[model samples]
Target: MATQNEVIFRLARSSRSVPRARALAHAVLSSWGVSQGTLEAAELVLSELVTNALRVRVPSDRQVGVRIARSLEDGLLRLEVSDAGSGRPEVRVPEDDETGGRGLLLVEALAHRWGVEERTGGIGKTVWAELKAPDIVAEPVGREVAAVLVRPGQWVRVWGEWRAVRTVDTGPYAAGGLAVVLGLDDGSALRVNAAEPLTVWNGGSSSAREGGEDEPG
Candidate 1:
């Protein structure tokens, strides 16, 4: 169910509606205090979904619908674009020369999950995508650890032991703006909020970048 934070808009079937939908998404997410990464991904996903909705052959009197909802409890932000068209969207492999056919591909790559469903009490379907909220950890004040930024390959103390940051997931609905998967030395793993005020250590560095599952520690 959508919370009180959800925003819905009726968009005209014109190219200009894409930017309008994106602007609405940005404003709503910003008011909710989402992280930069979350805002960027949500806007892109919104643009793609709206663009596709506009491309469908709907009646001139029918307007596309855009809905943005945030689940702070679940740490997720969902974007939904509804159109009167009757087709389901699918991800396709675009040829090297294709300028289009990659919208859903980008949506698939960026969204944590995405799909289409018939609109409630409506004649068409709503294409939706969910983005996991990013964890935004504020720097501790007046301490050396305050300067320690958490990213992939950074060593931070977890449960009194040092663990490597395996991956960072920042999408809407994530608590404190981000979640970090920590690599344990014993070949196990753990997940924690990056915003948690924990001590970070400068244990020797590795070349791992953010966004992927790490090998057993």
Candidate 2:
């Protein structure tokens, strides 16, 4: 059973529209309770696709199209950027000193999978990418939860949604405990106790366990 949600934005062929597209994607994904890491990847992927679309030489009246869709059950976030131009985007190796031409490279690095497709009844094409959702699970009792440390770049469940830790505070205010700040895709921040039972990925291994107490509220 796959649950689907989608949002579309039609943007003018302007560089300014790229950030707006990313902002809209951030808001929609936040509302869907997507993990912060996934949201960040999705937003970057969306920006690249939209930026590429805007760079294509299209008619002034032909607007760029951005569609962000999520399949909750499949744990996939799909992003599509459509344009009215004729040529498809290709990845080219960029020189180190060059200031441009790395958009698709960034997309390839961030997205789980990405490709191009021709738009139906349109003169241009749609470039799409899919990002895998963050791994979040319950903590195992006794041994596993005792050894883990909450660190930046780790994902933790907060308020029933998984969020990436942006910063960790271990000052006197924490009373020997730790405080963590989470970052949303839209640049918003959330603060939570590091002692809370939040799931953390164990390196690149195949398991995730609780890093703190038992089941956060």
Candidate 1 TM-score to native? 0.60
Candidate closest to the true structure, highest TM-score = 1
lDDT of 1 at 23: 57
lDDT, candidates in the order shown = 0.65, 0.63
Task: Please write out the lDDT profile of model 1 over residues 39-135, one tens digit for every residue.
Answer: 8999999999989998999787677877777776688888988999998999999899988999999999999999999989979999999999854
lDDT of 2 by residue, 90-154 (tens): 99999999999999999999999999999998778999999997442222211122112566545
RMSD of model 1, in Å? Answer: 18.3
Pick the lDDT winner. 1
